[model samples]
Target: MRKPCWFLAPPVSRAARWRGRCCTGGWRVRALVRDPFSAGAAALAARGAELVVGTFEDRAAMRSAMAGVDGVFSVQPSSPGGTVTDEQEVRYGITIADLAVECG
Candidate 1:
């Protein structure tokens, strides 16, 4: 059987759409969400996604979320949104990429 694909963002974002597509395509999905109880996360769960509560800043959570997954869809908030600076966004992307490799 194919391993799960990990999504590194909340289901409310673009990840939600991709998650649905993945589900329909017969791929198991695992999402890293900040709040598992949120409506978006709940919707994802209803659609068969395994939700892991974490943010990009949480290395341990990211590692845990990536465990045993076949691949990852890395997504991070960019600058001007104020959630993260441009440098931080780049760093988060790189970090997720590195972790995906390490997990493999």
Candidate 2:
């Protein structure tokens, strides 16, 4: 059987969880990132994850990235110096959920 596709959004925490998923050799991980050239993104790519270039703020991008995903793992940064506002975070989370429903 073919592996299910999992879309991971905003892979913070050094993407440890994402790396674990990649190493498990079951699901096909599709990680979203603003910069595909970034070190973290490169690491994920090295671990067999397919990189999708975009931010959570872009609904179109998110939807596009989630086109064939069977599951989604989204995380929002909560650093005191983070730029995203609380309302934006909520909106992005909702957007991801909505997209998952729409895609599924």
Highest TM-score against the true fold, candidate: 1
In terms of TM-score, how similar is model 2 to the real structure? 0.82
Q: Which stretches of candidate 1 lie over 4 Å from their true place?
A: 10-12, 79-81
Against the reference, the lDDT scores of all candidates come to: 0.83, 0.73
lDDT of 1 at 93: 92
What would the per-residue lDDT of candidate 1 be over residues 31-99, giving only the tens digit for each residue? 888988988888889888888888888999999989999899876876586767899989999999999
Per-residue error (Å), model 1, residue 37: 1.1
> In candidate 1, how many clashes are counted?
0
Give me the runs in candidate 2 sitting further than 4 Å from their true place. 1-4, 9-11
lDDT of 2 by residue, 1-104 (tens): 24446565455576577666654667777778789998888888887777778877777888887887667777765445578778877887788889889988
TM-scores of all models? 0.89, 0.82
